[model samples]
Target: MASDSLHSTVHQQPSPNLTSFPIILKFEEVVYKVKPDHRGLCRGRSSWSSTEKTILNGITGMVFPGSIKRRTGFVAQDDVLYPHLTVSETLIFTALLRLPNSLTNNDKIAHAERVITELGLTRCRNSIVGGALIRGISGGEKKRVSIGQEMLINPSLLLLDEPTSGLDSTTAQRILTTIKGVARGGRTVVTTIHQPSSRLYHMFDKVVVLSEGRCIYNGPASAAMEYFSSIGFSTSITLNPADFLLDLANGIAPDPEHASEQSEGLEQERKLTREALISAYDKNIAPKLKLEISNSRMDIYSFNKHASSRNDPTKAEQWCTSWWYQFKVLLQRGLKERRYEAFNRLRIFQVISVAFLGGLLWWHTPESHIQDRVALLFFFSVFWGFYPLYNAVFTFPQERRMLIKERSSGMYRLSSYFMARTIGDLPLELALPTAFVFIIYWMGGLKPHPVTFILSLLVVLYSVLVSQSLGLAFGAILMEIKQATTLASVTTLVFLIAGGYYVQQIPPFIAWLKYLSYSYYCYKLLLGVQYDEEDYYECSNGVLCRVEDFGPIKSMGLNQLWVDVLMMALMLVGYRLVAYLALRRVR
Candidate 1:
C-alpha cells in the first residue's frame, strides 16, 4: 500500500529539483521470483517444469524518508557506463534526459558540474569512464561516477546495491563516508552491503538483515548486537557487530565440536537461532509497520491532494526529447565510438592480408579456365557474407547491458537506438568490402569495364549489408557473444552449403533454402557481372577454346541476376527488420 503511494509520487513528480513532503517507501508482502535457476530450465527432467524460486520472500519493510522529496534513485551493484564517454559527458547526458526540458543546456551542464564536485569527481571530470579494454579512472572514481549520474537527478531517496564492493578497505570506507554524509543531508540511503568492515558497519542509521530471503532483523544499527544477544546468541564486546550478526544469520557460530566430532549439535543450534530470530522480528517489528501503514495514509491525504494538481503535467509519460533529438544524440555517440574501431590495426591487417592473398592466388588467369573465375566469384560472395556477419554478431551482446540500462532510464526509444546504430555503421561496413574488392578485382583479372566493376562492387556491398543485419539479429536474440557466435557460424555454414556452390543435388524439401541464403544470390550476381557475356577460355596447350555465349551464368540465366539483386536488397531490409524486432523483445 505504501509502495503504491511512492509509485504515484515518483510518476507525478514535476521536475528533477522539485521537493514535496518527505516520502515513505514501504513494501508489504513484495516477493521477487525467478524460474529456479538463471537458465529457465528444469535441471533433472526430460519434460519442461514450471518451478520458481523466491529471491525476496514477502519482504515487508519501510524506508521512511528524512528528506522532503520522493525522488528515489537506485545505483545497481555493477556500474553500467559507456567506456568511451568522459565523466563530464556521461553526467551531462544523463542530466539532459532526466532533468526537465525547461532547463537550458547551460543549466544542465552546471547541474552536472555540481554533481561532479559533490561526488569528489572534479579531478577526473574530463577522464573517460573506461572498462575492461580501456584504461581510465580508478575504481573509486568510477563508483563515484555511477553515484554522480543519479546525483544529477537530485534524488532524495538513494538505494545503492553494494556500492563499495570490490574496493579496498580505505576506498570502501571513503565511499561509505560519502554515503553517510549524503544520508545526514536529510536523505534516506539504503544499501545492501556484503561483508562490511566494523567501521563501515557502524556508519549506518539502520540495518535490515536478511537471511535466505527472510528478514531476521530490522532495527537501529547500534542496537543490533544487543538484540541478537538478548535472543540467546552470544557476542564479544571486541567482536565486530556486523560480522557477528551475519554469522548469526548464516548458521555460523562458536561450536564445542572441535577435532573429531560431527557437529550436528552446532547445526541444530544454528537452526534454532535462525527460527528464533525470524519469530522475534514477526512479533516485534511487523505489527508496528502494520499500524503505521494505516496512520500514515490518513496523515498524508491533504498533502497528496495539494501535490496531485501540481504534478499532473509531468505525469503523462513522454520521452525527455523528441524522436529526432534522440536519433541525433545516439547517432553522434555511435559515430564517435566507431571512430576507434575504424582504426583497429588487427582488422585492417586481416582485410588487407585476405585481399592480397586472394589476388595472388587468382592472378591473371586467362578466360579458358571458366571454373577458376567462378571459384573467385564464389570466394568473394562467401567471404563478404561470413565476414560482416561475424562482425555484427558481437554488436548487440557486447552493448546489451548498456542499451538495457539507458533504455530503462528512458534515455531514448529502442527504434531510435537501433536506427542510429545501423546508419552509423554504414560507412565502416561499406568501406572494408569496397577496399577488399578493389584490390582483388583487377588482380584476379575479372571484367574491367566501369559499369561491370561498379555493379560487382554494389552487389558485394549489399551482401555485406545483409550479413551484418543477420549478425545484429543474432547478437540481439542470443544476448551472449559466445552463443551468438556459435549459432551464427552454424547458420552461416548451412547457408554456405545451400549457397549453390558445393551441392550438386538439392532435396525438393530444402531447395527453396537457396533463396534464404544471400551467398547464393551474391555468387550468381558476381558471376553474371563478370562472365555473362564472355564466350571463350584459353586451352591448357595455349590455344583458344570455344565456350558458351553466356559463360558460366548460362545455367542460372541472365534474368535471375536481376532477381538475385532484388533478393539481396530484400534480405538487407528483412534482416535489419528482424534485428530491430529482436532488440525490441530483449528485456
Candidate 2:
C-alpha cells in the first residue's frame, strides 16, 4: 500500500490542493568548484593560473517536497556518533539542543521514542554506539540511529550519502524500506548510493546517473534503460538495470543488439562523451524541467505556510542552549569518555612497573651519598615530565575527526570543548603521578616528614599536568599522531638537555632555553623541598662524593622555589592557550 501511494505520487500531476503543505527544492545551473590546498608556502604563483576542479557543472534539478515544510537534514557518509553514549542518550542530547526550548523534557523524550520506534531501533535504544575498538550496535542499527537523529527535528527533506555502504543486502533493503515509508508519508528524501541490488534500485522513484561529476541521466527509474537505449546504448533483460545504467554512464555498456560486439563508430556518431551527455540533457530535459520548476513555484506561491519555522520555535535562540547547559553536557560526555581511556589497565600497570623498579634501584639511599639523592630527585622530575608528555600527544589527534564533525554541526563552541577536555582529564592526570610518588617516595627512603612528602607529591603532580598540556598543544598543532609523537619526543629531549641537571655549563647564547624547560623548574622545586644549605654530606668509606653540600636546594637559592612553582603554573596556562588556538586554526 505504501509503495502504491509512493508510485501514485510520483506519476501524479502537480495540484495545489493535493496536499496541505508542499515544498519543492530547486537549483538552477548549479556549479560547485573544489578549492586548491592552501597549506603550502608558495607566494609566487599568479592568480590567473588556476588549478580548481569542478565537481558539479551546470546541473539543474527540482526535488519536490510532499509535506509543506522546508526543514532539511543531511546524513553524511561517515557515521559520526559519540562512541560512549548509548543510542537513547545520543538522540536525547540532540533533541535537547536541536528541539526548541518550548518543548518540555518529557515531550522531547517522547518525540525521541517515536522516532526510535519508527526507525525499528527500539531494541537497541539502550545500547552503546561504539567505534572500532568497542562493541556496539550493528551497522544497520547504527545507520538507523543516524537517521533517527535527524528525525527528531522532523525535517521535510532528508539527504543521505551512501546510507548502505557497509551493510548486508538484507539490512540495506530493510533500511531502504524504512526510508521508503518516510517518503510515502509526504517527505522528500534525496540519497546517493553506490551500486545497489536490483530490488533496491527499483525502490527509488527516480534515478540520476553521473559520470566524472557530470549528470548523464535524470528520469524515472523504470524508463532509464529505454532512455539509454534510445541514446544508442544497449541493455539486456538478464542484466540488472542499475548495472546497465552505470555502465552506460561510464561508457562501457555492450551493444544492445550485438552482445559480443563493441562499437566505437556508434559512440562517435552519437557524440557519446561526458560533454555530449551533459549537452543532450540540457537540450532534451531542460524544457521539461523548466515547466516543472514553474509549476512547483506556482503551487508553492498559492499558499503561504511556514510549518518548519514554528516547528523549530527556538530558531532565533542563540548557541543552541544556555551557556551553562552546553558546558554541563560537554563536561559530562568528556568525563565519561576520558574515564575509560585515562585509567586504562595497561597505563596503570606501566606506572606501577616504573614506580616499583625505581624504588628498588634507589632503595634506602644513605645520607652521606648525596649524589644518589640528587639523581633520584632528577629522575622524579624527568619521569613524570616525559611519561605524561608522550601519552597526551595522541589525545587530540585521535579525537580530531569527531571534534570536526561536532563543530561543523554547530553542536558547541570550540572554547567550551577545549576547556572541558583540559579540565576533564585532571583527575587521572593528578592521580597517576601522585600514586607513583607515594610508592617510590617511601620506598626510596627520601624525606619522610609530612610536609616534605605532601609537597613532593604536589610538585610531581603539577609537573605531570604541565607535560600533559604540552602534549595537547603538540597533538592539536600537528593533528596527526605519528607526526606529533615524533616532534614531541624531539622537543622533550631538547628540554631535558637544558633542564639544569644534565648540562650544567650552559653557553651564554642558549642560556635562555632553560626558562622554557618545564623540567628545570620542577627539578629546582623538588630539590628545594628535599635539602637546604649548610647540610653536611660525609663521603662513604673508600668512596669519592661529588662536591655537593647535601643542600642542592640552597645552592640554587631557596627563594627561587616559589618562582619555579609560579613558572610551571604559567606554562600550564600557556600550553592550554596554545592548544586552543591550534584547534581554532584547524577549524
Please report the candidate that would top TM-score against the real structure: 1
lDDT of 2 at 493: 89
Q: Return the clash pairs for model 1, or none.
A: 367-537, 368-537, 368-538
Off by over 4 Å in 2: 1-24, 33-54, 66-72, 229-238, 253-276, 294-312, 539-556
Candidate 1 lowest-lDDT run of ten: 1-10
Each prediction's whole-model lDDT (CA): 0.76, 0.75
* TM per candidate: 0.87, 0.84
Model 2 lDDT per residue over 481-572, tens place: 99999998898888889887777767989999988989989888888788654445566776644433334433445455778988999999
Q: lDDT tens string, model 1, 121-162? A: 888888888889899898988888888776666666787888
For each candidate, how many residue pairs have backbone atoms clashing (under 3 Å)? 3, 2
Query: Which segments of model 1 are wrong by more than 4 Å?
Result: 1-22, 31-55, 66-72, 229-236, 251-262, 504-509, 531-551
